[model samples]
Target: MPPEPVAGPAADIDSLFQRGYDRLYADDSTGAVRAFAAAVCLEPGHGEAWAALAEANGGGAAAVQAYAHAVVVDPGGWMWRVGLAEALRLAGSLNDAIAAYRELSGERADSAIVRLGHARALSVAGRPAEALAEYREAVALRPDDAEAALELAEALTGSGDALAAVELLQPLSRRAPDDAGLHHAVGRAWIALREPEKALTALRRARDLDAEDRLGAAPLIAALEAGEGADLSAAYVRALFDRYADRFDQDLLGKLGYAAPELLRAAVDRVIGPATGLRVFDLGCGTGLAGIGFRPLAGFLAGVDLSPRMVEKARERALYDDLRVGDVVAALEEVPESWNLLVAADVLVYLGDLAPVFAASAKALVPGGRFAATVERSAEEGFTLGPTRRYAHAEAYVRATAEAAGLTIRLMEHCTPRREKGVGVPGLLFVAERPADRPQIA
Candidate 1:
């Protein structure tokens, strides 16, 4: 009798799935993608594996395909459907995402999350009228939902009705005075109405309610005094980003829809001409979002950040010729002033004072070297710490600061850096050059 064929050990699917998630949670997308692909191959109907695979891919064609399969394998699963819809949304398939959400609503019409998503999809798709209606409906269903009110109020404001945004929240305020977003919205609306006193009052309440200061304590101070500003310390920012590194790209690119990096790259090409063979320095280069955006233009790319975790993520991209975790100001101080371009996409928002960064930046660049950055636009005459614990700078302040630092503005224009509360956050992107003839400052 022929020797019995050796039996192969069974596939340890649970172990494989767990390992896939471990890699994903640690931000090892490539490893996680491989593990998840193996899990799915072992069991095609593994809805969770499919979903994990979708997340690993970060919402592209691969994610769309994975999520679609997940929903197919588990038609009755809520997360599967939600994941598919969200994946579709982030993939820029607005119509398909909306249709999927609508179909889900037909089956489970009471899901606030689904309706909220539907409203957002509609808003981004430029069907604001329909979006407004759905937002109103979502708010009605969950009157105390801060996120719902935020989106609804933002939508109202976008429609040129700040008063309505205020009015919509006024009743909610009495019902939930402890709601941070409620008071924050009221403060924003009051400012729009030009009622300084009322704005200060509501902003104070918002700060008090936000014990963790997620709404930021700096903005509260700004309302009380012209020069009052908030500083989001390096430690706070580093800690915040360390925890965020794993999902940074997804949250910023897919959901919040950050595009400042691309905007800065465009300004570089338009203002500096060909960027090829130029030395590029990326300040606060979190996850290399800005690094990859400008890599094609660089002969050499280098980056620095306060968050080591962010630096690590940036390193994985292989876009930078050098990446270091250090104080941005100090790093710039150490580097020789030979860079052709420096860009900080959404980095200065954590800093209340622009003078020092600008001064350091001015000294770090070669003659005619460019510094490109973005800041939240302030309506007043100076910089301010805002409700989001991020700093905003006035155009006047930015221009004066640039001149004082020996840099001349090449371009300064209004741009949408990202979406906050489902609305475009107003910002300014500028490319300023070190005067070729200016003597180096001691």
Candidate 2:
């Protein structure tokens, strides 16, 4: 039940389409659709009216059909096809968008914007390698475009071409020398390349850029200063909690099934045996995930993280009696035996070696206080620091390190706490007690 195309004067049809296009431009969708429909009625073969109607309808199947009709009437209309591709993308019809973009490639062979859109659409369609090439092509065409360069870098990173991404982003970093996010991207890319020195330099730049912002460049700045041989960057550790600070509960709890905080709380309860009025510190509190679990048990709760973002998020929850933004170990060092319990959940994974943090925690703890932590489990020999630079420690390694730092491993449990890349990597949930007297064990 569709109206047939009416063939009329070209000027009349063009005027009708113009009216509809005007309505669309004014954000009057209902009036635009009516005007476009009327224009199509005036001249059934008018490509512009049909294309206008298609776009006005938000690129649904009916809209697509209208665009097809327009293309059939005027096959040389490249702009109409480009609009059709955008409409298709909006409709989530990626395959149709790809087809339209491919058709566009024939008409406008070297349009950078066209290529960039096509690349983004292709990436959304899960063709990352092809998308990467398209992004690279777009960047080559528009060398001065920061967005093109960033997209190319993102595509390369998504495709596991990190070294190539580094090569691209490093130069872009210079161009956008004051963009903290850009420096963060460059630093991450350098880390992927296993170039820590380069990573350090870039991350420091990020911190300096971030310093202008109120949250400050604490993450990048501290990491640059403290992250060195056998220690994780302060910024990197800060970033973990900061990135997840906002939507940690909904994302990690809902999607990833993260339960480390609660599990650690239960482990602490079992070991400590219902101790009352204990002063607790949640190191790397990270949006108060650990605080929520430990709050009931503690006489008072203090939270600390390197990221001010995470600190702000934690503050919103009002779980911590007090929250501080600083490096975990440094914060712990200043506490002066104020805490009877210190809980670090999945925080050590960001640290390659635990001796310094452990020593700091031991120093922070009151006599006979306990340190509860969750660590990523690796093989007996221990896992090497990967491109992410997060270390997965072996059971023996943790035990040895704990004992070396004058802490006694009271309990160790092997549990499948979380799934990574669909592989169930073992996790170590342990309660290590700092002795009343400093006792060094081998």
Candidate 3:
């Protein structure tokens, strides 16, 4: 039985805590959060109340902090520490989560949960080798644990061992015939194996079983069915960049040999000459890489990106006068004729329909202002989403789009934006100017 609310200030911490539990079980997370928050406010040192608050928040940064507080208040509580680590993982602090799990593993080497958590964090942080080792350890610790085995199989599939993944998943899928996640994993493995029919069957079954589509089987199913490319979802793009935010600079510059920013900078200079204090807007700025090169040319610089983590990284550079996390098109549409120069470096790959972006760019730029960008080159008639899930645009399409947007193309040249699989990716760098004499589109 739950405690009834007491009148006014007479409400005791116990009653509030009980009420929080009641609300939580009733699926009223917001109300539960308020109740637990009040309990903590009344008794700040209550570790259970703090932990309850953390759970109600569903593992955001506030949950991480709440769990940390609970761990500090109740150092002997093993589950509190685990909650803290899991909260960190869910909050996208992958490195911190890895460290927390590592410390926990040092104390309890035999815990399968800790090992699984560590493996997941490592996988997200792009350390596949370490993640594989951790997954193996977890499965070895608990051979009968279906979830752990499934994770290991997924990791194998991701690491390009689709055959091994299929072998491991076959028995598991047979045993748990109705398990959506298992079916989804099998679908992905089949996709990697180039068996589209098998992939579609598994994915459709997974999708039907999981009506909410929590396993993300719908997108895979759609891609396989269509046999053509579409614009990647905003959520998908945001999550990808957020996961890579920590290692973006190192991986892009050192591993991928990315040079879109430099390429765009040179082209902008050639088209507009030396910077004379222009108001620059960096579309999809991405950790301020383009902003850094354009800063010398700008009296004021503003930037926007889709990923909050990526925006945070860009903010740390302190180059932009204004930085926002939002869709590039929405950001440009917010204020028209506001910028003297707009730059997009390696940004268009995620977008298939460039019409909105080009129109927005034209509207955002002042009269005679320059817009510079890079696009992966496609020999096809229009644009195509490639195997890498990035869009590539044909040269003719770029010219047609710019002209339709009332911008005059000053330069469009072949260049290498980045390297993938040890080969330079073909790209086009273009500078288009919004002509002063042309009537502005309302």
Candidate 4:
């Protein structure tokens, strides 16, 4: 009877799965995703369809979900598990990716690909020592793998072994002279070694070779040529903080002896005399350290930060009524006249120019609202970007800018907000108030 004419969802799922594979092979990922999605919807137990859907979507949360389903349905499918791990990594789920990779490594200890993926995830998660160990193992497994060698060299540079990174990268660069990434890595190693001229040459070559600017060499080149007034890029700051978020509190408080939050709180207390029931907004409210002190005084508490990971950490504190990932100046400008107190403890170091921030803060505050902040102090005439890539503003500049923004200076005192390299960093704690009778800025 010609196979009794296949019936039910099983036959339909098979047809859809075949169609999905056909579309996937033809490079029509969107159509393939739709087909595979339909097949899985028809039969949630179909592991193969879920795997195909994951492959079609490539890498994202959706792919992560589909691969996860496939892993659940057919736990023996090693490739599906690997795909799920990679999808988690690509979706910025670093901790989960690390966990998945750990499982895979335990199962297949000799797989170089698994080792490399684990190493990359660890490196991005800011666990440099662990990442370095994995990279070394991956390289050992595949001694001739150039990419593995390059990753190890980059990790070496990150771990502060500049000389070692240079020794590895120089020969590697010679072997692949046309590779832009190799050149960029070489440039970074040279910069760490304090060989600015050599760094410039390699960076320029990388920039010339990479028309798309994928490696972000332009900003580094600018920082090298224009030392003092150059502002750090938002992307750089966000990435730096994202990597640092997990270890931030411990590192800053315990190791660095950070006292910015306590100092700022004292200054605010002196200015307003234990004021309570104020509408408070914490700018760059990293891990909500500043917010913890201000929370007791706030009738309403809100925060904004550039790094999403930092914002996530802050959210966990449950101190903020509202939390957002955004630029501080933009956040200030967005909700003018909404806040009675604006706190920016140890945050302005990322910005070289403070005029815009001062103006925005003035406008954001109520007529009698107070703006408090800590800034690293510089002896330069205006402001300068320090070797650490943080901006330091001279007291004269801070006073002049606050006045220009129509904010009345209430307090500007010298203080040490934090310790760096076992030495106290010179800083200023300033509190400026918007005039009670002055009209808000347009």
lDDT of 1 by residue, 1-442 (tens): 1112123455578977787789899989887887788778778888887888888888878888988888888887788889889888888999999998889878777788888889999999999988988898888888788789889988876654566678889888989888888898887766654446667788888988888779874565574557222234464566568768999999999888899999999988899776588899999999999988898988999999987889999999989999998788888888658788989999998887788888898889999899999999999888877777688899999999988888999999999999998999999999999988886565
Per-residue lDDT of candidate 4, residues 303-409 (tens digit): 99988889999999999999999999999989788999999999999988899999999999999999999999999899987888788999999999998999999
**Which candidate number has the best TM-score?**
4
How many pairs collide in each candidate, listed in order? Answer: 1, 2, 0, 0
Per-residue accuracy of model 3 over 1-442 as CA lDDT, tens digit each: 1122233565688888888899999999888988888888778888888898899889778899999999998898888899999999999999999999999999999999999999999999999989999998999899768899888988876655666677778787888899888899888877776557778988999999999999899899888888732346565566568768999999999999999999999898888787768999998888889988999998999999988889999999999999999999999999999999999999998888898898998999999998999999999989987888799999999999888888899999999999998899999999998999996555
TM-score, one value per model: 0.50, 0.52, 0.57, 0.58
**Superposing every Cα of model 3 onto the true structure, what RMSD results?**
12.9
Off by over 4 Å in 4: 1-181, 184-199, 205-229
Please list the C-alpha lDDT of all candidates, in the order they appear.
0.83, 0.76, 0.87, 0.87
Q: Give the candidates in order of TM-score, highest first.
A: 4, 3, 2, 1
Clashing pairs in 4: none
Model 2 regions more than 4 Å off: 1-232, 387-389, 438-442
CA RMSD per model (angstroms): 19.4, 16.1, 12.9, 11.8
Off by over 4 Å in 3: 1-177, 180-201, 207-229
lDDT of 3 at 25: 98
